[model samples]
Target chain A: MMIDFSLYVITNRDLSRNKTIIEVVEEVIQGGATIIQIREKNLPTRIFFENAQTIGKITKKAGIPLIINDRLDIALAVDANGVHLGDEDLPLKYARKVAPHLIIGYSAGSICEARKAEEDGADYLGVGSVFSTKTKIDAGEAIGAKKLEEIKRAVSIPVVAIGGITLVNLPEVIQSGVDGVAVVSSIIGAESPFQATKKFRFTIDYLRKGKIC
Target chain B: MMIDFSLYVITNRDLSRNKTIIEVVEEVIQGGATIIQIREKNLPTRIFFENAQTIGKITKKAGIPLIINDRLDIALAVDANGVHLGDEDLPLKYARKVAPHLIIGYSAGSICEARKAEEDGADYLGVGSVFSTKTKIDAGEAIGAKKLEEIKRAVSIPVVAIGGITLVNLPEVIQSGVDGVAVVSSIIGAESPFQATKKFRFTIDYLRKGKIC
Candidate 1:
């Protein structure tokens, strides 16, 4: 399946505020989020699996890809379009060997990691906290646009910029030539996830059209 | 952490019949099942996480260990006492390196795999399908008691006999010097999970007392 990484929304139930993760996801997808990643870190296994299946159905029906974060078993259980894994999670080679059909996205913090992921057959790369942000307390130091650009140049696979990304600074991230922008609080945590998603989609389209930031 | 695998009950929700996995688990624990493995392969991620937390809490209060099947993320998320990995799951060495405190168990079908698991710092080995059973369609051929004995001799760590284990065959498995017995249908799928658990517990205790089968 060809995965569209543009305006990828990583779900954060804690940030959803008065809304279930599924509700926020529906709104975001309706507002033109190209991809959805179920990234809840603390939900019990059952809840996470249910949420993934619910969102996966929506994404599948809408022709959007649903990427499960960190849990390959859950991804397989839900028959998701793909899986998104971090450095601390299972290695890419093993994931590829086990689930060759799923599009595997690996988080890379450096040129070496990006190259390694590409060599290991990762379908895409998540590169960032291009800016310092609180969404991930342990996202390490911000890699900045220079490193993001370096990573993009170093790898053949598509790259999606993540971490602390918001509408205000997305232009700079887009300027780094990332294939997509992954957002958390700026969308799901917003007063209206639908509007926030629309704004992000508009900005990405405008920037990608070669408009000056 | 020392894991007591004496009467390990691997949850099979499909075989559970009319009861939730958590409900059957509670009854089994009350009937003296020592270790619990939440092995639901089809549950959504959210439901699995929730079940793990609920079961983890109950097991923690009862002083029993809960082992999550396959997904290390769920094990770490719920602070499970340990994790059980199949042949196709994450490599043992990497799992040990990442989660040093958890008691890791590996399933092995041969002496080489058994010895390798011990060398990789696995806390225990689950050697199985001692008698042909339909529970695991992909469990391959039955290894029988002879192979189980060889596996026990090959690995220094504790060994648990799994696959088609029931109260009727518990004696033969125990006589092979296995530290524990893992059950699926014979307990959870029984007409009364609680009563079945008690019977298996009694049989294990009786065999451990050096009585003839």
Candidate 2:
């Protein structure tokens, strides 16, 4: 399925200024985040599933799609809109088979991976570590905007740029032709996640419309 | 799906005497392990998926069921025979929905959980820590064979007893009316996994036939 999200805010509870994931997601929806990806790297499976259920309610009420990161089982259990898989996560083909109606997203750091993901039935591609950051220790070195542009051009599926994505670097990332941006620290780590997400939403809208923010 | 297996072996590479999981599985199969459940608690998701693929090939060639522990995604990705989920793992209802044809096993410690699992479409029940041991830190207190028999009577699905099950206690476990036994340290951590598995298999067979071994 083709995905239509623009500003995809990934949840990181540790960086959400002491708010629970549910609270962060509510604020994100209020700030106009088109979609929310629940990315808990260090939670027990049952807790994660419960959290997903709670967050699913908030997102559903706000008319926002909820995407679960790295856990298709949890995503399916909660009937979230989709699941996003990284290089080390579940393979796209099997995920597609397990949940044909659920949107499946694959992470791609190169044009080769991007094309393969699209061919393998990924609804969208999460590309990058476009700029280096401390959010994910294993996010690898930054790929920069040039590589992002090449990968974007290589696939027909939507490409979402991620990692170290802040307001300062978002314009160049948008110019790389990605369909959306997946942010962590820029939104979740901000003093006010709502304000930060609003700024991101406005900037992406301006950039997509070919106007300077 | 009705599961018909006697000796269910769970892989623990750490206790396999320096052998790779594949090698341990080979030995277990040689000793007549009716089914294998790949339980990699520490491997990365991609590596776990790869290991499942390798074990899947072995189980497929041997005409035995391969049950991936706690990872339905990897199980489906490799076309395993089933997936075994614990209390903290994926919910059985969603797993049943995800893979209707595959055997789904649920871990239940009480009669309420067992009946609920069967009602929720679990093909079989893995009931245990039948005896407490150091193998699984979170296995909880030993439920004893009395509890096992109670749980067994509570559900119509096949019950596979797990946790600290050794040949010495195997007879009592069988007398509790379980359909099979799931062993970790008793087989994998043995000096000869094949011999250990063989003895357990033979004992189980003899016990089932109502004969003293």
Tens digit of lDDT per residue, candidate 2, span A1-213?
A: 235568999998778888888888888789989988999886777788889999999888877899999888888878899998877887788778878888988888888888998999998988888999889823567999999999899889888998898899989999888889999988998888899999999999889898864
The prediction achieving the highest DockQ against the true structure is: 2
Output the lDDT of residue B131, model 2.
93
> For model 1, what is the alpha-carbon lDDT of residue A2?
69
Candidate 1's C-alpha runs over 4 A off are B1-213
Model 1 Cα shift for residue B2 (angstroms): 26
List, residue by residue over B1-213, the lDDT tens digit for candidate 2.
245569999998888898999999999999999999988886777789889999999988988889998878788778898988877877788778878888899988888888998999998988878998888723567899999999998888899998889989989999999899998998999989999999999999999998863
- The residue ranges of model 2 lying beyond 4 angstroms of the native Cα positions read A137-139, B137-139
| TM per candidate | 0.58, 0.94
CA lDDT, candidate 1, residue A129:
77
Q: CAPRI verdict on model 2?
A: medium
- lDDT for each candidate structure: 0.84, 0.86
Q: List the lowest-lDDT window of 10 residues for candidate 2 chain B.
A: B133-142
